[model samples]
Structure formats: C-alpha cells, structure tokens
Target: MANTRSSLKRARQNVKRNTRNKIIRSNTKSTVRNIVDLVKTKAQDALDPQKIYSAYLL
Candidate 1:
C-alpha cells in the first residue's frame, strides 16, 4: 500500500523494530518475575544484597 519507495522502507523498518521491542519487553518481564520469586521464597535475612542490587540495575 506504500506509494513511495521511502514509505515502503519505513514500513519494513517498523516491522523490524516492533519484533525487536517485543523480545526486549518479554525478557524484562521475565527478569522481574524471577527477582520477585527469589525474594518471595527466601527470608529477609537470607536475601542477598548483591542479587537485589543487580536486579534493581536491570
């Protein structure tokens, strides 16, 4: 449906960017879920500060 060459190129770029974004979003959600599970299954005293810090950085 793109009438111009530039528009066709832009459409392709959008598709590529969309797929890349979806992968990044999924990975971020998985990392957060893992961090939450780690905190939930462990006692406060047993939680590792380093792990918490790293998760926060992510």
Candidate 2:
C-alpha cells in the first residue's frame, strides 16, 4: 500500500503510463504485420512507393 500522498500519485501515474504504452505497442505490432502481409502478397513492381515510404515514416 502507498503510505504517502506522493507515492499514491506516482502509482496512479504508473498505471496510466502502462496502459498508454500497451496501446502503442499493440498498434506498432499490428502495423508491422500489415506491412509484412503487403510485401508478401504484392509483387515488387506492383507495390506502391507511397506505401513503402509511409511504412518507413511510421
């Protein structure tokens, strides 16, 4: 249990940050999977240059 006010506040912040991090991590994983699938299914000549550029920007 948190005994001090500061400790309690820190604990709450940690929970918020953890949730935010999880969301970001999940999005990154999903984006990577989508890019991989696109690369596999599309021929090199048929792939969109903008898509590859956007993936690098992410």
Candidate 3:
C-alpha cells in the first residue's frame, strides 16, 4: 500500500474511543445521579430500581 496510514487515522481512533467512553461515562453518571436525586428529593424515580436498570439495558 502507500506508506501505511496517515496520522489522521490515529486521531480518528482516539476520537471514536473518546466519544464512546464519554457516552458510557455519562450514562453511568446519570444513573448514579438519578439514584442520588431520588434519595435526596425523597421522591420515586420510577417506583423501583428495576425501572432504571431496564432503561439502562437499552
């Protein structure tokens, strides 16, 4: 092939990885935050944790 790939390839890989990690991290954070909010506000988020867990599955 031509001299392998360009530096952009590595950069793109990093971008993809960062995006994936960011999304997952955000999800986990929001999950925990939802739990915290429920406890702090003393209100039911979904009547049970099962609802949150099921939502995370998607």
Candidate 4:
C-alpha cells in the first residue's frame, strides 16, 4: 500500500507502464512467431529481405 501522495502517484504510473510494456512484449512475440511460421511455410519468401522487413515493421 502507498501511504504518501508521491508514492501513490508512482504506484499508479508503474501500473500504467506495466500494461504498456506487456502490450509491446505481446506484439513482439507474436511478430516473431509469425516470422518463424512464414519461414517454415515459405522458404522462398524468407530469403527475400523486403518480406521479412515488412513483417517486422508492420
């Protein structure tokens, strides 16, 4: 429990940052998983730089 005003505000900020980080982490993991699946299913596209770049960027 946060008793002080500053501590309470800090706690709230931590919660918000945690949720934002989780969202970013989830997106990154899913993007990697998608890239792996693409490589396994289509060897040709995997070699193409543009395809991989697009996958990670978008």
Candidate 5:
C-alpha cells in the first residue's frame, strides 16, 4: 500500500497513461496490418502517393 499521497497520485497517473498508450499503439498496429493487406491485394489505389493514409503517417 502507498503510505504517502504523492505515491498514490503517481500510481493513478501511471495506470491512466499506460491504458492510453496501449490503445494508441494497438490502433497503429491494426491500421498498418490493414494497409499491408490492401497492398498484398495489388490495389493500385493503396499504392498511390496522393492518398492520405493515416497508417502511412503512423
């Protein structure tokens, strides 16, 4: 158990940040996989440089 106020506050902040980071990282992975699959299908649109694919930015 955290005996001090600061310790407890830090623990709460850590939990919140970890959850946020995990969600962002997972979404990035899923987006990349989807893009890769689209590329494998030989979709010319997927290869276009003009298209703004969020996965590419990640």
Candidate 6:
C-alpha cells in the first residue's frame, strides 16, 4: 500500500519498532505483576530494597 520508496521504508521501520515496543511492554508488565505477587506473598527477597531497585534496572 506504500506508494513511494520512502514510505515503504517507513512502513518497515514502523513494523520493527512496533515489535520491539510490544516486547518491552510485555516485559514491563510481567515484571510489575511478579513484584506485586511477591509483595502479596510477603517474599523475603521482595523486601530487599537493592533487589527491588535492581529488578527495574534490568
């Protein structure tokens, strides 16, 4: 559907960025969910400030 070469290139870039963003969003959601679950369960590691800070850093 892209009529010009530049548009086709942009379309390809959009697809690549969408895929990458989806992966990052999924990972962030998963990490947040895990942290919430750990807090609810009162897990010892979750109580550590360093570990919790490091989780988001990763």
Task: Give the per-residue lDDT digits (tens) of candidate 5, residues 1-58.
Answer: 5569999889999999999999999999999999999788667766767654765787
Q: Please give the lDDT score at residue 35 for candidate 6.
A: 92
lDDT string, candidate 4, 1-58, tens digits? 5489999899999999999999999999999999998888688877889999999998
Superpose all Cα atoms of candidate 1 onto the true structure and report the RMSD in Å to 1 decimal.
10.2
Pairs of colliding residues, candidate 5: none
Per-residue error for 51 in candidate 5, Å, reads: 22
lDDT: which is higher, 3 or 5? 5
User: 1-58, model 2: which lDDT tens digit per residue?
Assistant: 5569999889999999999999999999999999998888786745779888888899
**Which one wins on lDDT?**
4
The regions of model 5 sitting more than 4 angstroms off are 43-58
Give each model a TM-score.
Answer: 0.66, 0.68, 0.52, 0.67, 0.66, 0.66
Better of 1 and 3 by lDDT: 1
Estimate every model's Cα lDDT from 0 to 1: 0.89, 0.89, 0.84, 0.92, 0.86, 0.91
What would the per-residue lDDT of candidate 1 be over residues 1-58, giving only the tens digit for each residue? 6469999889999999999999999999999999998888786645879878888899
Descending-lDDT candidate ranking: 4, 6, 2, 1, 5, 3
Model 3: residues with Cα > 4 Å off, grouped in runs = 1-4, 41-58
**Higher-TM-score candidate of 1 and 2:** 2
RMSD to native, candidate 4: 10.4
After superposition, the stretches of candidate 4 with alpha carbons farther than 4 Å from their true spots are 44-58
Query: What tens-digit string does per-residue lDDT give for candidate 3 at 1-58?
Result: 6445786788889999999999999999999999998796655656568877998899
What count of clashes does model 5 give? 0
Better of 2 and 3 by TM-score: 2
Give the count of colliding residue pairs in each prediction: 0, 0, 0, 0, 0, 0
